[model samples]
Target: MQILINLDANHPTFPPGTLDTRSRSLMETYIKERFFDNLMYHEAVQKDFAVWLEAHQKNSQASPKGKRLEIRKIRSAAEKGLNTTTLLGEMERLHFDARNNVPDKQINFGLSHLIDTDFLARMAKQAGNPDIPITQRRGLMLFGATLMVGIRTSEWTTARLISDNPPVLPGETAAHPILVIQTAKTRKVDPEPRYLILEGFDRGALGMIEACIEMTASMTNGHLGQLVAGMRQAMLRVADSPEAFELIEHIDMRTARKVFTVESRRDKCSPEAVSAALGHTTTNNLRWYAQGDIHCERLTDIPLARATLNAVKKVRDPLADFNERKQLAGGKPLSGYPDLGTDNPNADLDNRGSASLANRLINPQGNR
Candidate 1:
């Protein structure tokens, strides 16, 4: 329910502050110790080279050239990624036994995982319901967007969202109003606008959650700053009230932004589109570590709640699809009196011979 950061049913019920600290530690340690150690498998296979070097360092007369040949042979053998896998396998055999026990909640989102449309649809379904918890609402809205849209966690910040109401525009249509936004990272000169449709939007569901955000914003009078802070508080609530939801993240805002980025790319948004949607002007500007982009699947991949309803009317109306059909096909004459037997259409042979008999019909040559 808390989106990326989930509660471990098996873990002890630590206080909010303690739970927060542990979550941060786990996210960090899991990456460095488990993930990186497994990821740099080739390097892990060569770690004994360091120990061998240390031994050589102790005895300078040791055949440095002989050691090089042995190293070359080992390197050749290592080219087989199976040897690399063996490093991970060895690590698993050694470290993954008792330590195999991990937290019940998974934090890391793999790139392949975002294709789960069911997962994203579930977020919308859960949030579409008004009775859902405020804490759950906070997490799903942002995380759902990240998962569905493919954004980087690092770009997520206090000032970027408005949990209460979307940013308003002048003379904008009531159906889909454009929201003005400034980039949180580049802080570009001119702010850009994004249009989001609220028609058929589950306002009953979203409005209830916004009420809490509005209450938090009212604590401050200034509109711009209060809007951002309100969003932050709501997200923190989404993470779970530090009092109720077990708030986490000790590293810094930068780390949290990274989390946003990772989850977003996981949602399968191409890097370019995601960058544009998030207010980044270019992909080159993002750090190499950031989830750059993902390819989109199809039109069905995006939300079309109201538009989909419009498609239903065609099923009942016979002429509902008339715009796409050719309506004038039947008006053609039967080919200008077809006696299509002649190779040259104007031969006049029938008139030359048959006029003798037909003359009786026209003039009654011998009788009338």
Candidate 2:
């Protein structure tokens, strides 16, 4: 004897072993819209659905990974039969095995791509051009601000820039500027706003925010969502152009966060400092955005590396000088020591060596 499985009997809101006509209709409509039309939750259609999924995979033109996700959703919704549990288990195993065969993908772009000098220069140039549309220019400014500030895309939509009576200027030499963001993701019990102080190395952040405000000042109430949509459209135009922007392939707000974290680290800023800048209370929350390779092999003049080398040289030079001075002050008299500058034939050689070491210790860079 064969047992039958009632597909709609498992509806959460309806009574057990009973199917509500309205809910069944709604489910049918959802399946048609999400997967395909004429799909029935019956054992007889299982083979047909499998065949349809294969055809859909080919015709949808979606990537293999995306197709896998769609298949999983379909399996979850359609699993209702005597063999449903076994079938679902087999499907999962197949997916896992198939994924194991594919090589692990490496991150093609990271902080360097986001902060590429060429890309930033182009954005800045476009934003300042008076000939460009006001909306597009404003979008450029928004994008620049997002990149510089490392705020979430959603946060950017609700952020505000407020200054003192005079209104802070926009330049590297400008006074301190602050950006206020009404954070969306926080503990429900105690919600508070966050502030980003734009100054010092990140002084350019203020310029971007100022430009955005200036462009939108004519409107009485300009919505940040609309402004960001305009910017996204502008970026899409660049991405579609023949001579696309260098880093325009997949640049988004998430990329902005990674760029900020990696650039901060490269600038010798501690993880704690970066976390605080990103409005996180601890470094644990920062790991996701700070996954870029720390030791980049690219040939570039890393400012932090140079500063570190200089610091090491400073310490070493002082220690060398101290050791030389101590030996000279406490060692035997010049006449009693043969290695010293005494009345010996090799006195000139010893004096020359001492002079060279002293010069090296004094001028670590070897400059005259």
Candidate whose lDDT is highest: 2
How many clashing pairs per prediction, in order? 16, 0
- Which pairs clash in model 2? none
Candidate 1 residues lying further than 4 Å off, grouped into runs, are: 1-115, 121-133, 145-176, 187-271, 285-368
> Model 2: per-residue lDDT, tens digit, 144-249?
6655677766665466776553243332244455666766666656655665555543334555666655554454334654655566556655453443544454
Worst 10 residues of 2 by lDDT: 301-310
**In model 1, which range of ten residues has the least summed lDDT?**
305-314
Alpha-carbon TM-score of each model against the true structure: 0.29, 0.41
TM-score of 2: 0.41
Error of 2 at 163 (Å): 4.2
